[model samples]
Target: MLIGGGHSHVAVLRRFGMRPMAGVRLTLISRQAETPYSGMLPGVIAGHYTRGEAHIDLRPLARFAGARTIVDEAVGLDPRARQVLFATRPPIGFDVLSINVGSTPDVSVPGAEGAVTPVKPIDRLLERWRAVEARLLASDSPCTVAVVGGGAGGVELLLAIEWRVRHQLAAAGRGAGHIRYGLFTDSAHVLPTHHARVRRAFARTLAERGITVHAGSAVVKVEPGCLHTADGRSHRVDEVFWTTQARAAAWLRDSGLSVDDRGFVRVGDTLESVSHPGIFAAGDVAAVDPHPRPKSGVFAVRQGRPLTENLRAALAGRARRGFRPQRRFLSLISTGDQHAVASRGPFALEGRWVWRWKDRIDRAFMRQYTELPPMRAAAPDAAPADEMAAPGQVPDASMRCGGCGSKVGASVLDRVLTRVKQPAAGRVVIGLDAADDAAVAEVPPGRLLVQTVDFFRELVSDPWVFGQIAASHALGDLHAMGARPATALAIVTVPYGIESKMEETLTHLLAGAVAVFDREGVVLAGGHTSEGAELALGFAVSGDVAPDGVLRKGGLRPGDCLILTKPLGTGTLFAADMRGRARGRWIDEAVASMLLSNGPAAAAFIAHGVSACTDVTGFGLAGHALEMARASGVGVELDLSALPLLPGADETLRQGLVSSLHSQNARAADAIANAARHAGDLRFAALFDPQTAGGLLAGVSCAGAEGCVAQLRAAGYPSAAIVGRVTPGEDGERWRLKIGD
Candidate 1:
């Protein structure tokens, strides 16, 4: 599993993509889908590079490497068990692990964390930068901005913000005279680590740009609108950006690995953790023990190739290779207005041509990730479009919809619901076409009512796919309780756009949902719709169950075998998808499984006379299984390896990708009996992998467990597996799991 989408990890992914090991599977876990190239960040702020131009999209890179992309943050590590813990998911096990999570900026000064924005984790910093830009453009009054630190980063960012603001004003026929820019440093001179000549060049440039240089002024504290220096000077400003000291994630210090006082992982010359074999650290997060270096993107970039080779060798049980960074390297720092300064040791030069050289190198580096070999299947024919509205013609949501007129247009609703004909069952005495406020249902003499409601914001980028998954997921509740689905009431919220486009999108979505409804023989009664910020869908589904026959979670008995009807890992995969970290094929496969109804699986369980069941959803397998185990007053001995998994799940888990709900689900670890003993096994991570329209988890009689699994496979659930068995439990027994025992 590869953690962090930092420079070295990207190199590792690209190499692994080009050449695959016969039996090795790779997973890339990243906190963000796109990592901003540190080299181009200043250029981006200066408005020379667009967001796309400056970012490396780890999604395609991970896919190209045949790796599963998981978007999440690593929280801690258990070296003895070989498992990496996350803030929001179950611990991920790995035979080998590498971290390149990069360093965060220090915000240690009182109120600094809240008052001033730090610079590393460039994605968030970029977001704040845009807001500052907008505020500057929107304001009629003058503003002052301060950048703390005399380092190269502080200097470049200050200049870039100034340059971009000036150009924007000039473009709008306004001059930049209204804005004041300042740079404060604790040291006597800026570019504290660079050649004297280079510092002189920037000092001259800042003076020329009319920027105030606050030399030897250390910012000791920050307030909402200003900062105070250690010398007792208070500088009031509209915005304060802190870039003084580099800091590492606290999780590193907590991760049972050797780390420097700053919390950066301590590593050997080879970049492997000095104390933990099979686990490696790189980029700013890794502090070389013998030869420590200041954190720089250039050094991280240089580490990529060697990191890849060493990782491959270690994975294949070969001798590791040594990669020592050069003692000196070229530095081309942009001055924010298309000019740059070049420094090599004591030699330094400044010119526009230097900027061009730097730009060429940066763009060339970006191309490696952006220009990937396409892998999607042949494109389908385009859907016919209604004439699009001209720019700015899309209606503002607030302008419409306080009354009945705000509802979806009757004609459009009619067109969309034409496919949702009522089922021929007598349970529906009055249906959708009747146009009543609500539909009437008849409960059979021996049946009890079961109702469930579910709704969510769109997951997939595609509307049709989103609709299908929503509908299927809503019905999963009934399937878990062994109820026969009967009808549904849909509540939809569609974004305000061109009338024709909105209608078309809604039609596709409803059609997709109706297809599933038709298969399950469920009728779409009626519901409401409204204009909203984004498209969202939900359902209040009603099903039937015989009171005596209903499957409650508390029905499990000792000696019953546990059967999981489908695979795990939908949560992390979808979370990755939301960030564009997951691959298309991975999503396609997940959707296919999601759309595969739990109807048949429910029936298979019912046929085997099993009453203990629950569908694994956002809480993950471990969570739902624990629910069943605890409620039934029994313990579950899960054979971790026997659990079925969706394609890319294990890979994504290894890469540290997990859903936002992963942490909550992982909390169920308190219920696992033997987790710590075998927590390092990568397969165990699947337990906390959340599912969308996931499979059924049930306890069947030991005598019928194998037969029930056979029946489920015969019913089209080929991935179904007998994963565990219910065991005796004392009120206070400790472990409830036996993973890879």
Candidate 2:
């Protein structure tokens, strides 16, 4: 699975989606649904385009490519096990893994924590923009905005905001001078890193916009309402945006991967991670050598084709080709007003038409994925001239089967096990490859039996991500039951491949699964492996939930408040993901949500007086909630607006997107009190959206609901919330999903 849906990886996803590798499964893990294109962000901020116009949809890309999508952040890597562990969900196994998380702004500067918002992540910057805009709209006063760093990003952003604020003011019948903009840099001039001609253009633009440019001024501290410079100069500001020095994500430095001084992954020309051949790095997250290039989206975009090629080769155990980056690339910098400056080497040009050219290039790149070519239909077979032919073309083939039906065929499993030796054991009664119905274990008199089984097909294509989700999903059963996991038996199946390919596939998958088990004090008990046409995993786990304090699904009571530990919508998101229509940031957000295990949430639920609970999985909120309500002989009134949905879930549903399993889930909504009333609401549809490695749905007392949610959020389950309440059942049959006011 590709981790971090940044620019480079988005390109890789699109290319792979168009023409996938025959036997390879692709998955993408990201923290956001829409990854903003840096090149168009200024245009967006300047009001020339909307947010959607500047972002790439990762969900549709994954769907179109038949890849799985895991929305999560990778926490660590177990190279030996070929697994990537996430903070939330299970560890993901992969034959090949790639990282393109991109860089974070250097917010480590003094006093930056409270004073400035970093622009590197893009999301934070958008939020800051909202806050600034709101404040300006709330009063008839001028707003002062300060931007740190005088590089291309900083200059462009300052101008964009200036133009947007002024435009908004004029639209509101206010004076254009209602907003003040400033740019600060620890350099002799603005755009110090660019050519003199480029610098001159930016200087002229800033002057025309009446933006104050502070050169040779080093910021020492960021105060609440002002930035204090090293020379004891303080500039008052309503909002401070960070666009200064950029660096790799902090997690990369300790990930055991080879990194440069700035902590970016060190990669060769082929974009392979320096220390691990099976791992690759690209985009702003990677530092390429032989020609040290600046951290620009251009290089990341160019590297996508070669990176995808090398990943396929690496997985196939073949020699990989190198990526050759252009020595010089055209730089088209927007002026936030339908005009732009173009620079090639030392040469330069500027005009409104240049901006139009830049716009066409950016839009065309986006269209390649959005407006995909339809798959060509197979030709009809020849028959006698008199034979009648159908007037219309045949319907496209049905999508591949999913769930249990997608399991590996029996013959393929047996053949692979025949060549492997079994582990030696004295007391072992059941062994892998024995074709037994259930695993057999010896139970001593004093020891109690703890059993948990987890099964799920690939939700995403990236091996590492699939490994994480699989492991996390397996571990959830143990955590839910309050068990200290003892050991795990993995049942993994990969697409058929050569010996080396099989080895790599098994290695990465086990690595990811093992990493999760290892962290939970569990051992890898011997299990089975086989080849199939798709990837799937199941774990028969044993753990010790204290005999005196076992948590079960049938413990809820009336008068309890319902709490959800994480956001919903993996099903709808993944459905959209398949079409390559979901945005990168949305996929990222989904994966992050999935990777988050219910371990912590479970503990908090129990401690906070949780009466009953169940992890929200394939059946979704309404389906699972119905289960709890029926089991407890109580009725639930779910506040639809209170639902914590994954990013882009509502939008996707509004667009009529849904998971393959959504129909079955919607059928289960018959238990709902007024399903028809919410039949047309997109937000309500998400109530039936199937989830994988989702959150925990708990029932707590109404009085403790707010406090419990606060505690959960404080304990790191930030998305936790009180989604509804339980009450005495009306006729003891109906569960209601109320769209609250």
Best-fitting candidate, scored by lDDT: 1
Each prediction's Cα lDDT score?
A: 0.81, 0.76
| Model 2, residue 567: C-alpha shift (Å) | 3.8
lDDT of 2 by residue, 142-235 (tens): 6788899998888888888888877787888887676788899999999776789988988998999999999998788887888888788988
Q: Judge candidate 2 at residue 294 and give its lDDT.
A: 81
lDDT of 1 by residue, 590-675 (tens): 88899999999989998998959999888888888888877887888888778787787777777887888787777777777677
Which of the numbered candidates is closest to the native, going by highest TM-score? 2
- Model 1 error, position 616 (Å): 22
- Model 1 segments more than 4 A misplaced: 373-542, 545-741
